[model samples]
Target: MNFKPIPNKFEYLNWQEIECVAKNKRSTVIWPFGAVEQHGPHLPLATDSIFVDEIISEVFKLFSADIPLKKLPTQYIGFSPEHKGFAGTISLSSNLITSMIKEVGSQLSEMGFKRLILINGHGGQISLLNTAARELRSVAPGMAVFPCFLWSGVNGLSELLTKTEIEDGLHASLAETSLMLALKPELVGDDRPNEGNKVEIPKGWSLEGNAPTAWLTDDFSKSGVIGDSRGANESLGKNLKELLINHWSELIMNLMQSDWPNNS
Candidate 1:
């Protein structure tokens, strides 16, 4: 049987073609997760979803067609309780998210797939996805599960952004705005808000760090922007896009060439 590399998307293949790839000992599937949540007035509600989807698609394009890698459809709604009060925000329960991961993972294991990579785009669901990945691994022990954040472990961020932007720019901020400009400038709104950076916690505490608080978007940001976007531009967005594509492509290529947990 002539088997395609399973590039672009997994869902596009027929069941027989999918089964062929699944039966390959080194085959891997990536499932991207994103959120339909608030990203301030300057960005679309599907910012997270769009970023993850587009970035992964670009990563897929970098691989040789001979590689046995395929991406599942992007899960567009994620656990986003912090953005509950904002318009256009859709947050799923933690239980529901975990259950979805397990059910899909179990099926993949049954089909003889070797790996499931959850590439998540939203920061709010990071812990939840980690928990879900472990639970999926527990049930589908034969399948390796990797829950990864889209923005984590990427290089050159500090070189492009300030310490303040790195730490405080949590949401629809400079990085996000600039990235959106590079990807889909039509979806970007005209407003570039500079709010929510002043909600001070005690020294040594942060919105998300050691001694983090259970904070909601409404608790600090009125404009639904958590950092300054005044300095964002398409040039920075292009740089960020390049960084993401190059990073993920290298990581995934390494994964495809090795057995990892199953390697002796």
Candidate 2:
């Protein structure tokens, strides 16, 4: 079938155009990963998916036409065992996720693509994706995969949110709710319950850090919220959207402009 090139969309191009673009050693493909999981009572099950899809689309829009970057469709379902306690949460097996990444990366490598950037929105799958990336590199030496979390390396979060929110707001919290309010306010529920903040642990131990615990959503939160969402508003969400878009745009632009992995 004949097809028209739709800017930076990988799937929009016809097979011939795809092959031509893939032949470029500087060509980069972005695959956004997110989860079909619970986000407390106030948010939709596809919260993670929606956020990453919107953020990546905005980031791509900011890039110039000369950038050799194209995006694949978003991987909506992800590894989310931590949220399995809540209804409507679908958790994929770790092996399945790793194998899927390997298979996809292998095909991209075979197509002569040089770089694969997996921008993941779900925090639960970070290490799994990292493992998949490393394994993909081993199996397919022609292409490099960079697994990135949505919130990582983004600046200006401290200016808009409190330290407690940054640390303990793991799910369905102020930042997420606010960002959702900015991106998809109609999907956000009005009941912003402030729960899951009173649990106490040892001094050195933390929920997530160098020392971490594999806790379930039902453990500390009956409502499934892991932080306070009292002051969540649309304004905060707007600021968050800008920060995310700017951070990812700069990062991907830098990647497109360099030949870092192949430089050595």
Candidate 3:
């Protein structure tokens, strides 16, 4: 049986039906943005991409079921591999990732997709994605491309999370570990240890400091974890997932209706 939902037409539909749906529906496309990154010893390397895909799949189902909304014009998954370092991490350069997103956005705009939602999974790609969104907006004035981080946009879920000593959630932390367990329990490891070290970049070092700056996971933490993952559990993961989906759904609806300023 063909499991592919959006791309495969025969099992779910045909090209003609897809075209008709696109023409009749409000033209919006959902892009699942993901990264090939290391997730420690226990988890699979494609953890980030896999999780993002799963989230997008669920969101598609929700839209189809509850909203019964017209099918979106287009939906696709894109990947960048710029984080390749810790054994399984694969990454594209920041420039390449930005350009790819811009091109995709441009193509979508040309296809009359006025609204594009980028469902991003990796924390490291946020800056590049932000830049890409801005460029896309400039290139396509009437098009609106909104980029959202799945882990960050969830409602008050962050406040509910147990705090760790680290400033920001690191490579793999309670939140991510919990998410993995919730999404892909088989991939989570039982023997891996958690890292609770504080983020200590060199003095005056900032994520926005300057170009040519470079650092490795070893420079930050010993176990490649930036926060505590010890307390993460399946229940928390489920709660977080629900919170994210609900919050994101609301946000997407708002964005679809909001007006884009001419000068912005």
Error of 1 at 76 (Å): 0.3
Model 3 global lDDT (CA atoms, 0 to 1): 0.63
Q: Over all chains combined, what TM-score does candidate 2 have?
A: 0.96
Model 3: CA > 4 A from native: 1-25, 65-83, 199-215, 256-264
Model 2 ranges with Cα > 4 A deviation: 1-5
lDDT of 1 by residue, 179-213 (tens): 99999999998999999998868998889998899
Q: All candidates' TM-scores?
A: 0.96, 0.96, 0.78
lDDT of 2 by residue, 1-264 (tens): 965576788888778878888877688999999999989889999898999999999988877865778899999999999989888999999999999999998998888899999999998899999999999999998788899999998999999999999999999999999999999999999999898887898999988998999888889999989999989999999999999999999998888888867823
> What alpha-carbon RMSD in Å does predicted model 2 have with respect to the real structure?
1.7
Check candidate 1 and list the clashing pairs. none
**Clashes (N, CA, C under 3 Å) per candidate:** 0, 0, 8
lDDT of 2 at 187: 98
Query: Alpha carbon lDDT of residue 262, candidate 1?
Result: 84
Model 3 pairs in collision: 9-13, 81-90, 81-91, 81-92, 82-91, 82-92, 83-91, 84-89
lDDT of 3 by residue, 120-183 (tens): 7876677678888998899887667777777774667647685442245556777778888999
Q: Rank the candidate models, highest TM-score first.
A: 2, 1, 3
Candidate 2 vs candidate 3, lDDT winner: 2
